[model samples]
Target: MSAELDPRLLTRAREVVSSITGFRDDAIANEAMERVVRGELARGRSSADLLGEMLFPQSTLSGTLVRAALVGETYFFRQPEHFRYLSQVGVPAALRRGSLALRGWSAGCATGEEAYSLAAALQASVPHGFPVEVLGTDLHEASLETARRASYGTWSRRESAPRLFPLYLDGVDRQVTILPVVRRITSFAQSNLLAPLPERFGRFDFIFCRNVLTYFSLSAREAAIALLARALNPGGLLFLGAVEADRVPAGMVREGTPELQTFRLLGPGESASPTPVPRFVERAAPPAPLIRRPMATPVPVRAQVTPPPPPARLHLEALERIEGGDVDGASAVLESLVRQAPDYLPGLLELALLRERSGAREAAVPLMRALRMRAERLPPDQLVDGPEALPARFYQASADAYLNLGALE
Candidate 1:
């Protein structure tokens, strides 16, 4: 591969790849296009033939370029909070609302892990024999095939991943297959966010499109969100990546006070209204009969008291700054958050990582030690009091690396 390109070709390459896969990384897009161009040239295809494909990026040849550029890196139970919320609140709430069957979609699902994880969680939460279906979609055919195989290596099982339910059958040679029960409820297919999801795939009770939209162009991202929102059942939940969390689609209400970055699609007659009343009345009530109705008691309107910002919100703000490449701003926010809530584990851990990243190893040591001490006092499985509610062992394991490295120094 030449790895060299004309400026015009590079610009056109980015547009074509972005149109096909919605990838925002120019370097990856350019590199992949160069490699594909070389292959096409070697295959005796003329430059004009390649230009035609660029004009129609949805063609099979263009899909090859997209597959080349995409990085399919995902693991089972990648973010546990979404799964935790599903089991604790989402599932129960759906049952309470009289949902007979549960359906879920994992948009941008790289492989079967997330889809299978969701299936396992739903199976555990719902009653026996209750219907459950989970669809995992990715643009890559190889990834979709791997998902269909339902087996993963040790790398897919990170320490941070929690076992919210039975996820695997058994391990052999460091690879495990997802349990048959879970696999039975889960399916994988190749699909693009830029296109409409098939109508045969009905509205879902919840959808996990986490960490996927970050690759899209701005307009495409908004369009994709609309599709995801539209795919949801009224009052359905949408889980997004932390970086993509703030971009709540229209007709959706962000849920929870923490930085879980989940949203709820408004059901029929549901309003993302400013008035936080118990329930919305359909229409104007008929005036009470003038003679017989007793005098109504006066209802007092209370002042809307704003609560102080939680450590989680501050932490999320800091994370957003970090993602925006504003390291100094993120550090300042984390510092202020720590002063306000010194016991906040996630903040302390994040600050320590930032410090370590900035080559201030000594500054990071105490933060690591403090977090480790707090984690040790709790049972290993006990969830720390924080935004994601990750277990104590997770913090301990995270802190151990820094603490051990410091000791080595």
Candidate 2:
């Protein structure tokens, strides 16, 4: 139809479409906006009504445009290799190092597909007895709600490894529900990376901040990365999107075989606890206590919390497996850690690297992406360089790996 809409209205519509979708093309954005406007008109809504319904939540006329802008498209296991790496290398290393009590943050988790995938993988990989805690955060309340519910459709499963499906999800009526086993180990919460983290959540060993960084401007990306660096522990690993990984600041190790790029968290002198403090209490005002105890009731006090015993020996065993070339056996241990504590980024990074080496690239990408997304909000000082850079021999090996993957193209 001939143009009849107000010039300002058309401009607002185009801007909303572009901002939401991260599409810079004016023509395509305009077309998308036109379609939306036409659909609203067909539903017998006035221009103002369409604008109100679609855009007007954040502010009045101007704010509504921003509200209407949202880009949401995702699926479970969208990137497979990243998960493989987590299962094989990252998880095992974290477990061996006795970082079972891990804090995992899924930054901009979207609809929670990746977070759920992590939970499922850990559940399938862990040995008979261990506990794991996982938490996912998203800025969009709607996305957080979807993640909390943990429900998906057939499309979410389209790219999932068929063999692992039964181990993770309950597929019914074309809808896949996260199994109870997965849910028991994972939880979802809402958060914004731009602000200070919620008091309830602290430093995390593993952080998944994938794909989301590409959507932000460079300044925001840098700020987010700095925050993520701070959020991680020394030697804690970071995963990133394939495209985003190279963009990460120097100081963090950026090496993985095929599907993943991992940034290593340097340790204190190569031999220190992954989590230096076992029971770190946040700085806050003390809670009010009861002044009088009833005859049957005793005054409440903080429980005595003990740190778990170190797993240095288990870590040695993992190294033995690596030396013996029993990568799968090593992976078994790593998977256990992920199952018991999937938030440990170092373990996830190690596992992702192993998977890439073992030709499981399809399974490593997600872990890398997840880590990348999480690292975006970490503190920048975490990227400080260590004295030892990669050896010359390792660079040669890396070149060969790149050539094998046809990445030179």
Candidate 3:
């Protein structure tokens, strides 16, 4: 088998993928393409024959390439604040329209976490027996099968609150499954975002397409947004990733704070309105002291008591526990250290990875964000003092976390 892939073969693979999925060549890295080429060669297929299958409109090879190249990384309650707003604001608004039925769509719903999250939110918001329907669509059949199963591991629950686990999920032997109530309202299907959505899918009152458009080419992004806008009911809401807020299409007005990353479709004869600024209640300052207390005569101060050990010590202790395979104990110690020093890079990265493994990736975001902010403020030379400091490793870990969460550009 040839280790070298022909440039023409790579170009053909890219074109086939782009035409089918609207992903650019750069979006699917060369490494992934090489893997596909090598796999075909290992199976005794020549490069020319593999290319022919890829270029064929209905060939299974094209679908295989799409699945292999496009990664689906999602967890439950990813960006919980989005679900909070959906429950508090979006659901209420849709219910207010006096329609007996409420419909929501999770486009590009990888493995059904986001779709199930939306269903859970709506279930919590609406009264019993209210007609609520949630549709989750993705391009990969394998992911759709996973969505249908509704069973997930710690990786899926990392960001999910413990309380929510008992409320909405059934956990047994380290696998947590979405409950029947959530599954009842949600359905999954194989569909491509670049292609025309099925007519039976119908219009939706709310649509979630987060962290997906960033992978698309500009023209593909525009086309997908247009299709989404057309699929939305008048005054319906669309939730996008924060990074994509600026690219919302015409006839749709951004709603809520920029942080919410929500957009609403404007009906005929309607004009876009500025999102209302949130009003925070100001707590009154405690009543001023009647008078400034005069300084007391200082007695000889007692020798200062010894201070507690620094967070770095606790971090080191946690590392020992982790090395010893007491992950739970190590996590407990790391959690305490981070609470005391949220910006401690070493502990922060360790804890974030722990949270990720435990199915709480969303919970890890702020810690990673803090680390990123700190790294950005300081130069490499100023980032560390010793091997244990590991500032460069910290920065790299932060970058990796952001990439995992789809927060990095």
**Candidate that scores best on TM-score:** 3
Better of 1 and 3 by lDDT: 1
Q: After superposition, how far is residue 160 of candidate 2 from its true place, in Å?
A: 6.1
Q: Which is superior by TM-score, 2 or 3?
A: 3
Per residue, candidate 2 scores C-alpha lDDT tens digits across 81-129 of: 5566566666776778787565566777778877777676665556756
What is the Cα-based TM-score of model 2? 0.54
Please report how far candidate 1 places residue 307 from its true position, in Å. Answer: 41
- Model 1 stretches astray by more than 4 angstroms: 1-6, 25-28, 273-409
Residue 153 deviation, candidate 2, in Å? Answer: 1.8
Q: Write the per-residue lDDT of candidate 3 for residues 1-99, one digit (tens) a residue.
A: 656677888788778778877764455555567777788889999878987787695688877777766757677777665776777777787788776
Better of 1 and 2 by lDDT: 1
Task: Put down candidate 1 lDDT per residue, 1-409, tens digits, no spaces.
Answer: 4545445555666677777776554224344567777788789887777777777766877778778766565678877767877887788878888888999999988877788888888899988899999999998988999889888887678655667799896677988988888888888878899888999888899899876665555567678888888899877889886445334579988765224668888878987864231121112343344366665864456856566589988987886675445667788899999999888889999898778756687898899899878877766555665545665655665665445445544
Candidate with top lDDT is 1
Sorted by TM-score (best first), the order is: 3, 1, 2
Give model 1 RMSD, 1 decimal: 17.5
lDDT to native, each model? 0.74, 0.54, 0.71
Q: Can you list the residue pairs that collide in candidate 3?
A: 154-359, 157-359, 158-359, 158-360, 159-359, 159-360, 159-361
Task: Give the range of the ten consecutive residues with the poorest summed lDDT in model 3.
Answer: 277-286
